[model samples]
Target: MTDTAHALAASHTLWELVGRRAELTPDRPVLLQGDRRLTFGELRGRAERVAAGLYGMGVRPGTVVAWQLPTRIETALLSFALARLGAVQSPVIPFYRHREVGFALRASRAEFFAVPGVWRGFDHTEMARALGAKGVFEAYDDLPDGDPSVLPAPPADGTAVRWVYWTSGTTSDPKGVLHTDRSLIAGGSCLAHALRLSADDVGSMAFPYAHIAGPDYTVMLLLYGFPAVLFEHFALPAALDEYRRHGVTVAGGSTAFYSMFLAEQRRRPGAKVIPTLRLLAGGGAPKPPELYHRVVREMGVQLTHGYGMTEVPMITMGSPDDTAENLATTEGRPPEGMRIRIVDGEVRLRGEAVCQGYLDPAQTAQAFDEEGFLRTGDLGRLTDSGHLVLTGRLKDVIIRKGENISAREIEDLLHRHPAVGDAAVIGLPDAERGERVCAVVEQPPGAPALTLPAVTEYLRGEGLSVHKLPEQLEVVDALPRNETLRKVLKYRLRERFSA
Candidate 1:
C-alpha cells in the first residue's frame, strides 16, 4: 500500500483523513467537474465554512440531515461539511419521489433536508415542503456557508453512528442501514488497496453521490490524493466526451456501465472508446465472465468486478494483478481484515467495513448472526484462492419440476449469445412446474432477433441442464433499471411477465 493509503487506513474518521491528505498534498486536485476543479486545501476550507453554516442552522453534532442532490462538487462539499460537524446524514437518491424520499426522511427524522430546488424538471424543494420535511432548503447551485471560527470542535470519535443509507427497497420499504466513519473509511481503504491505483490515476463517478458508494469512493480519492471527474448526469455518447476530455484512467459504475461502454465500442469498431481508459471496475450487480472477457478483449482494458451492497460498501474486489481467469470468473479476494464465512452456501461477512446495522432494532437483530457476521443473504462459495463466486440469490432460485436452478448461471450463459446484449433471468408463477424459468433479454441494435427456441438451443449448446433452460423468452428494447446504478430490476420484470 502507498504511504498515504497506510495513513488513511490508520485514520479514525473521514474528516481526519481528508485533513491529513490536505496537509500532505494541499494543492493536489481532489474533485473535477467539467472545467472547474477543487484542490485538497480548498475542499477542507470550504467544507469547514459549510460546516459552520450548517452549525449555525442548528445542525449540531448528532443532528440528522438528509440531502437528495445530484453528483456535483457542491454535493461533495456539503457531505464533507456534515462529516466535519459529526452530524447524522441520510442521503436519498435524487431521482426518488415521495414514496422512497418520504420514507427516508421520516425514518431518519432529519432535522434539516436539503434539495436541489428544481432538478431534471422536478420540484424537489416543493416536494420536501409537501412532505412536511423539517428545515427544507435548496443546496444545488449554492451551499450553506459561514465563518469557520463559529463552529464547534470537530468530532473526535469515529465509532458513533453518523450515516443512514437506504436499500433499493424494490419489494418493500427501504431499510435505514446504519454506519460510522470508521466503517466507511475501512470500506474505502479496501477499494484503494484492491484496485492498485496511484496518484496519477484519474477516476470518475458516473453514479449517484447519495449512494453508499459516495463515501466509499471519496475515501479512495483522499487516500490516493487523486481526482475523479464527477458527472451529474451520465449517459453514453454524450458522457464519452467528458470521459475522454478528463483522460479517465478508471471508469465504471456497474455491469450496466460496462455494457454501455461495450455498446459504444461496438458502434465504432476498431477504435478505442475512451483513449485513456485503462481500467473499468465497479460493483452493485452481477458481472458475467463473458462480459469481462469481451471488455478486456475488445476494449483493450482490464475489467475488475467486485461484490458489495448498502450494508457493506465493499466485500470482495478483483485485483488487476490477479490471474485473468480469476478476475473474469470470481469476485476478488477480501482484504486482510475482511472475514468471509460461507455458512450453508450463504456469504457472511465480518469486518470493520461492515455497517453497524439497521436503524430499527428488530431489523438489526435479524441482520447479524450469533457470531456477529453480517448475513449478506447472498449465496456464494470461496475458491481455494479465496475468490468469491456468487451464485443466484436465495430468493432468485427457480424451482421447476421440483428442481432448483440458478438464474445467474443461465444469465451468464445467455450473455455469451451474439444476439444478446443483456439478460435477466426470472421465475414466474407456474401451476405445473411450481415456478417457470423465463429469460428477458435486450438485444444489440441491428442484431438478429432472439427467440425462445434459439435461446434454449444456445443454452443447451453452452452445457446448461434441461431443467434450467428458460421456458419463456421476452425480448424488449431495454431492460428496466433503477436510477442509482442502472441495476436490472428483476422484480419489475416479474411484475411485467408474471401474467
Candidate 2:
C-alpha cells in the first residue's frame, strides 16, 4: 500500500478525515455544481452547523436517520452533517417509491426521515408522510442549521455500525447491509489508491449520491484533495456541457455510462466528446471487454472498469498503469487489505471493506462462510496475475438440454458484434429444453437490422459452442435499466420474454 493509502485507512471516522483534509487544504474545492463550489473548509464548517441543528432536533449519536434525496450538493451536505453527529444514516435512492422506501424506513426503525419534496416531479415529502415516517422534513436547497457550540463531542469510535444501505432487491425485498465508519473508509481507500488519481484531476459524480458509491467517491476526493462535479440528472449530450464546463478529467458511473459517452462520440465521429476527459472509470455493473475497447478506440480515453456492489462499494479497480489487455479482460486487482477467495467458483470476500452484515440475523448468518468470508453470489476466478475475471452470477447460468452455459460469456461475445450496441443474455423457460438461451440486443443507431441467423453465425465464428448458441434473439430500442448506475435489469428481461 502507498503511504497515502495507509493514512486514509487509519482515519478514525468520516468526520475526522474531513477535518484533517480541511486543515491540509482549507481552500481546496471538494464539491462543485454549476456556479456553486464548496471548499473543504466550508464542507467541515457547514456540516458542523447542520450537525448542531440536527442535535438540537433530538438527534444523538447512533440515532437512525433515513434520507431519500437526489444527487445534489445539498444531499452531500446533509450526509456529511449526519456523519459529524455520528448518527446512523440510511440513504434510500431517490427513485425508490413507496414499497422500497417504506421497507427501508420500517426495517431501519428510523426516527427521522429526510426527503427532497417534489424533486423531479415526485412528491417524496407526501410519500414519506403517507408512510407515517417520523420526523419528516424537507432537506432540499434548505437544510437544518444551528450553533455548533451546542453539539456533543464527535464520535471517537469508528467500528460502530453507522450506515444501512440496501441491496438492489432483484427478486425479493431489499436487505439492509450494515456498515461502519472504518469499513466505509477502507472501501474508499481501496478505490482512491487503485485509480492512480491526483489532486489535479477534476472528477464527476454522475451516479446517485444515495448509492454506496456516494461515500466511496467522497472519500477519494477527501483523501486526494480534489473536487467532483455533482450531477443531479445525467444524460449524454445534455450533460456534455457540464462536463466540459467543469473540465472533468475523470468521469463515469458504470458500463451504461461508458456506452452513453461512446454513443455521443459516435454521433460526432471526429470531435472529442469532453476535451478534458482523459479517463473513464466506474464499477456498479459488468463491463463487456468490447465496450472497453470502444471507449478507448472511439472516445480516445483510457477506460478503467471495476467490480463492486451494494455489499462492498469497491472490490477491485483497473489502474491507469495496467496493461490494456488486463484492463479490458479483468476487473483489475484488490488493494492491500482486501482478501478474495474463490470457493466452488464463487467469489468470497473478507476484509475491512466488507460490510458488517445484513440487518436480519438470518440473512447475515447465510451470507458469510465458516471463515467469515462474505459469500458474493457472483462467480469469478483470480488470474495468475491476481486480477478477477467474473464469469457470471450463479443464478445467471442457463441450463439448456441439461447443459450449463454462462450468460455473461454469450453477452460478452455479442458486444463484440459490429451491429450490437448493448446486449443482455437471459434464460427463458422452455418446455422441451427446461431453459433456452435468449439474446436481447440493442443495435447501433442507423445500423442495419440484425437477424437471428446473423447473430448465431457471428457467435459461431467467435468459437462459441454449438450448444451455447443463443436459441432466440430479440432486438429492442433499448434495454430495461434501473435508474441507479443504469444496470440492465435481467429479471425484467426474463419477465418480458418468459411467455
Compute each candidate's TM-score over C-alphas: 0.99, 0.99
For model 1, give the 10-residue run with minimal summed lDDT.
1-10
Model 2 spans > 4 angstroms off: 1-5
Candidate 1, residues 1-499, lDDT tens digits: the string is 7975896678888889889999989999999999999999999999999999998889999999999999999999999999999999999999999999999999999999999999999999899999999999899988888999998888899999999999988889999999999999999889999999999999999999999999999999999999999999998899998999989999999999998899899888898989999999999999999999999999999999998999999999999999999998899999989999999989999999999999899999999999999998889999998899999798898888889899999999998898988999999999999999999999987899888898898889989998899999999998999999899999999999999
Per-residue lDDT tens digits for candidate 2, residues 218-293, read 9999998899999999877888899999999999989998988888898889889899999999988889998998
**What is candidate 1's local distance difference test score?**
0.93
Error of 2 at 198 (Å): 0.8
Worst 10 residues of 2 by lDDT: 1-10
